[model samples]
Target: MVLRIHFTAEDLLGTRFADGPAPLLELELAVAMRRRRDPDPAFARRHRSLAAPAARAIAPLNELVPATGAGPFFLDPLSAGLEDGLELVRRATRTAVRGELDRICRNGLPVTPLLRGLAHEDRQAWQQLERSLRAAHTALVDPVWPQLRAGFDTDLAWRGQVQREQGLRGMLAGLYPGSRWLGSTLEIAVAKQVEVRLEGGGVLLLPSAQWTGEPLCGPLPDGSLLLLYPALTPLPHLYLAERAPAPGADPDEPVAALLGRTRSAVLRLTLREPTTGQLARELGISPASASEHARALRRAGLVTTARAGRAVRHSCTPLGHRLIAAAGTPARQA
Candidate 1:
């Protein structure tokens, strides 16, 4: 079924994309996907690795969001926002928690015993909820966060360009095939039939790497939208680690001649845009030495660097991407 989202003048003005993914929301979605017996092998591997802790981590949350579907009754309070630190969860308020729980019960949805007690503002329930979120982060997200954050950063850059040149109407129309802009109305393909009249309330479009396909759409208390959509295209390389060079790119010829072996290795490692510190640790090079090479490559226009959050990140430019793909012959013996 299609969810028809009607936008008012104010909503059109207020509608904007989210800055990035919400870790907690992503976790919730991941757990939901697991429950449904996800078919994709890539997602299956990631889910299997979390099997031990994930079940325990997801027990409480499963009440809030089932594997196959979610009702709006409890979704909003669980947003936990986009705070990279998971601060929204740490500061989860009892008042807000109580209201959402009350609403869920009123809506006649099933709730776990733990969720029942939480409506009474039980400290134990709150603490357990907090711990589950944190544990899930450590077990499921921490190992992959650097790559996740990098994906988010890159996706935002692409979206910014799309919105700036084409405008909101254009962005909505071009976002993905599952969604289309029908004049003032925006229709999203979803299993549930929902028609929301967004009276100029803001719409937060979140691009998630975790939710493999389709999109999740909901409304917030503030009358804003929470649209979480999987990336339309396979994001650069979400499930795969970027290789430094083509498998047979010779390490001793062509471009390698210009940068020397050590420096050559540095340039190729940047295909994934690792931070200066990360790159150094990976290559066993000193930070100072890595920085020097980064600067040299930046000057040569073969690579570029940007400050992403606390890390000064480096990435190969298109020129560099092409150069590396065409470089190196293979290990040549003496």
Candidate 2:
């Protein structure tokens, strides 16, 4: 069970990961996982109170996304946000929708009256789809979006660091559990055998909080190699909720209490291994304060400080990396 993707020089040069998770993709996969009865224990336990209500809310579209399909089906014309994604679906020409449905059905027949009449009465189908999508997102994702968004940003930042420090090859090598980078080729462990050769379309790596198992790779309508892989920092909803501060509490107060704001900022700023002076300047605090914080971090085994002649450097230790990762993602931008 191996899927091999051969990349060219141009493809290697252009391949890049997505900045953050797409709401529609997460919704699609989360719903698919539910349909197949693949329950994520942590997710289930945490969202249990709301699971039943959420399921009932989106029950209308259960038939459309059956537990079984002819093959993996991608949402047509991908979009990042909920409304934008639905807009793309709605804007898709009836012919495009029908062809996609045909492929998914694999029987050359419509799966439902809405699908059957999609060529003629698409507005109704689109409306139903949008309704279900909104309900599902509100019930399943909105409550936990802040944590989810932070998880995504943290993972993306780590990936960027890997790329900068170890090159693109290192980034790809760390991408998936059963995937490896061998020069220009990426060997994937998959149930279905697949062989793809990239032809200047590059690659889009999407980290999904809802995904589990091996990465799913395929060609998009635009002919790009899109790989949907599980996020490395997949913080469970239960875990996040437990750590979340009480309502009306300042979120930063907890960490700030644990480590004074100056020291905490110094440690986080050193995630990039800056000089004590550089860190001090960045935090707008005195260089002595930064040095003191670095020493404290070193004592706590959260960071390592080393000297290169007259120049001293500060970098995060494994424990420090873990701490930052556990802190959750940064604010997201559109």
Candidate 3:
């Protein structure tokens, strides 16, 4: 049930679809570096140490791209509305990322509802946005593609060598259980590694290039990369789970062990206060079964039920809060 994977930077560069375009890769790398270099000394030191090589490799990219300081890419409406389209894509990406992270951290499982909704709601808008960005990149930024490609290829090769030497696969396997090692690719030639479920689930994609030498992990066969660079492999449906504690009362218990069928059902219904009937409808269980579980939770001090009008509503108690908080902590540390 556990999968692990390793990727090198070269794999990332290979995923580029454009034959010629401005070096969007460099811009993205700069943004990543800025994020990694936190103001806090300890955090900065860690990230910087991990990101150093990637940063050094892309040094030339910095020179070529230069910071605009105008905020994310903008399009002049009069020109072609490219900026507006890019902005829309940026917003969509942020929303998707945040939703996935929230689902992972809170539910201890991927929440398909959040992501599925985006696809349904914005399919047309996303398609149009993609077209606009592509047109802009091809028309306005094509001059820099050759230089960008060279820089990207060199960095990816170097990063791959480092990963191979350092037993990156073993390190990743230890860090991420149930991860599968997939090959690498390039998003604008900024080395990205991928891992996907061999059986079923979502893919994880990560960018290997960093300023401090820290490992980068992302969705396997990341959709963003596929959309921007279509010449590469077909993008797969990737479920990204943010690093989070497994759900349950005991950290020592395996997720499977702690979240047995009944416990999981109980936890889901009790996440927020609900009456027995509401719990039954949510869980597809009989009212009697729901009442039984509520009683069990009450006995465990995880829930407190009171009569409101004619129906009983179950709510979490202080003890329940403590249990939830404890469960939310990183399982490894706990």
Candidate 4:
């Protein structure tokens, strides 16, 4: 059970990371996570709580992106944004739609009226799908978009450094679990064994916030490979309640009393490894104030700060986490 990707020198030269997170691809993974997959219990519970509205909304997509197996190529259309991607899906030709539906059936998914209508390019069915996609994005993606964006920025910065210092092979080696970079071939362990020839088309690396599974690779509409991997940071923020806390709520009083209120909040914010500016924006403090607190925490070994591009990213160190735990702060769900 392995997926071997054969790459030529030209393919390596052409390999690149995506510009940012793909909303539609995230939606697909969100649907898949809900559908027959094992995920971290904390993540699963949080996802279910957040995705309740999207569960029904994603019905039209279930047949295409099943709990397992191949889905339609048009699903990840290499678009830069959600609306653009949806528009691309909306314009999928009847022949293309029918071909994909037939492929799904061949993979053992039953054909239903929705699939049938989509196969025939029914106008009402496409409309329903568009609405459903919009709903899913709003429910599952919109709430934590800022967090997603921050995570994306940090991942790209770190990956760029990896690419610069370790070259393409090193970047691929650390991408996902069960993957190895062996000379000209990238092998990934999976349930099914298959070989892919890049043929100089290269690969587009897409980091996903919601995809907790093993890496997935497939061809995009443009004949290039799309490799989706979990983002570098785990999204405990996703496990948080959607509602803002009631005014004057102090969940971190134990830690706050020890570290003072502002510093305590800063510590929790660093759990997601926000940039200095992002921390400032999140706490309504100046960047200098944020940096000062971060420096203090770093000096105390409570957090670690690293320069990523022009921004400095801060993350809670092991000691910081233990301190938060000892103080009995909720910190994050997991």
Candidate 5:
């Protein structure tokens, strides 16, 4: 049977976590400890501390914490099967950071930054504390490191070749089973795009591109893509979804009307809780244009606006979501 591969850029991005080599290297020592059944109390304490902040950062993305399962795992909210995996990541990052710090310090490297810019005496004290932390991490992962490293190296070599040859599309096809390419071109066309920096020092790339595809491209169920980049932690995942079209939309709608339609589409994609900036960037329109379109949607009773801090946030009314969902195919013209 010919295997029909559903691929998306988002899927390829997600694979960077489970299938990428970097994570394997980070997790090696931790896995080793597990294999040896060594219980390291200090490592456990630091892990718990790290998880608190990590969980707080991830909370807005969803109601529940992500689950951890066996190795080579992918998180599909639609499946509702994978364990909440964020905690595992929290521990892993902490372990890696501690290890790197210790490695530097043991070689008599400057430990000032790791000590929060303290003076020499304070730095020495911090170094002692760091050593304790490193010991804990080593105890946690030492046993499984070797096996995890071997597997990680193999996958990385394979994926690196795929990325180099296929670019984004071919790599995604190999990684995900059911992703659809929405845009006609390999490079997604969008208006203005912005990279938003998160509190965790991570970046979110927001682009407004016209999507084209079938099956996965059409109206999908309530779930979005969580893309990961192997190089970055904290804000690794990119959330993506297709915008539903507007109903009773004219084939020859004015640019203003088209802008309105696009605004509605963005709000739907955001579940009616996107910022003006996010809307503008995603629709390839100016902030002024985005504001005007939002105002129009509000006037039409399609969207409601409220204050999220100093910024205004938009959400669709039930009537609006239904209207957009009923609009069927988007107009061919921009």
Candidate 6:
């Protein structure tokens, strides 16, 4: 089956990629994927690793989002970050919470204690749900977050490159698995048939590291549709524990030697497409130092720096991607 997204001219103009992956959405999808049996060996291995604490960390979430059917959209609030999203969930009104839970239950999902308490606006239930989300994120997301961020950056860079070279339609056609850009409409492959009219509401495209299934289409808080799919840039190392660096060997030594450790580190971080301040914070350096390093890379044609509003964003150039790839880095796909 396919999901047809009809678009207007304004919708076409407004459609764009999100700034980065949505942490809350990714967390929910990761939890959902972890519960199922996947064919990938890496996912299987990772699933097995979480088999012990997985139930306690993720069981309550099933009430909010059962094994099937739509869950409460409030769970994946469109916010600045995970904590902010969780706060939104915490602050969801009683009516909204009850309405969504009632809707889910109507779909045949059982009324668990969490769901019942949430439906009744119970404070303790909210706290328990929030704790489960935090614990699940710490277990499943924190370990691979940096790598996921890097991979997302690589995919965003690629999408930008595609749009530059192939126009909006071309980029949209290859945006996700089985996506077809058919003039006024974009079609996406899914298990069920559905149609969405983007009557100037546009759309937000988000890539996922954990969701290996078909594309997911849902509404954002702002009424814009969100299309979530597996990230295009492959970072197999994130899923494979054996891919870790061997004992006592510095995997980055070659790149560090070539570009010097600090500069090389800066180059690698550019894959996350961070701003000067973000780079500074991540590298524990002053903004001045980060700017200098970025400037050096830009001068060497290994990085591209762009000014967005007041912030200067740094991204890897194709040459920079090749150099990082040669160094066997997790980010930067060539």
* lDDT (tens digit, per residue) of candidate 4 on 165-270: 5677977875765478788899987787889998778999887656656678887767789888766543433224223331233744655544445666778888
Query: Residue-wise lDDT of candidate 1 within 1-334, one digit each (tens)?
Result: 8878888888778877776666666666665666666434556666677666566876666676655445333433334344534565445467766776666556554877778667776789777877776776666666666555555664465556456756778666545554778888988777768788776677888876555555667766687887776553222234353434323335445554434445566777788788999878877768876786676566445578999998999988765665555553332211
Q: Candidate 6 residues 109-157, lDDT tens each?
A: 7888888788787789888988998888788777787767765775676
Every candidate's lDDT: 0.63, 0.64, 0.38, 0.71, 0.36, 0.71
Clashes of each: 6, 1, 42, 0, 27, 0
What C-alpha lDDT does candidate 1 achieve relative to the native structure? 0.63
Q: Which residue segments of model 2 deviate by more than 4 Å? A: 51-53, 66-77, 107-110, 119-122, 235-334
- How many collisions between residues are there in candidate 6? 0
Which candidate, 5 or 6, has the higher TM-score? 6
lDDT of 3 at 95: 50
Pitting candidate 5 against candidate 6, the one with the higher lDDT is 6
Pairs of residues at least 3 apart in sequence or in different chains that clash in candidate 4: none
Candidates ranked by lDDT: 4, 6, 2, 1, 3, 5
Task: Return whichever of 3 and 6 wins on TM-score.
Answer: 6
Per-model TM values vs. the true structure: 0.62, 0.65, 0.24, 0.68, 0.23, 0.69
Q: Which is the winner by lDDT between candidate 2 and candidate 3?
A: 2
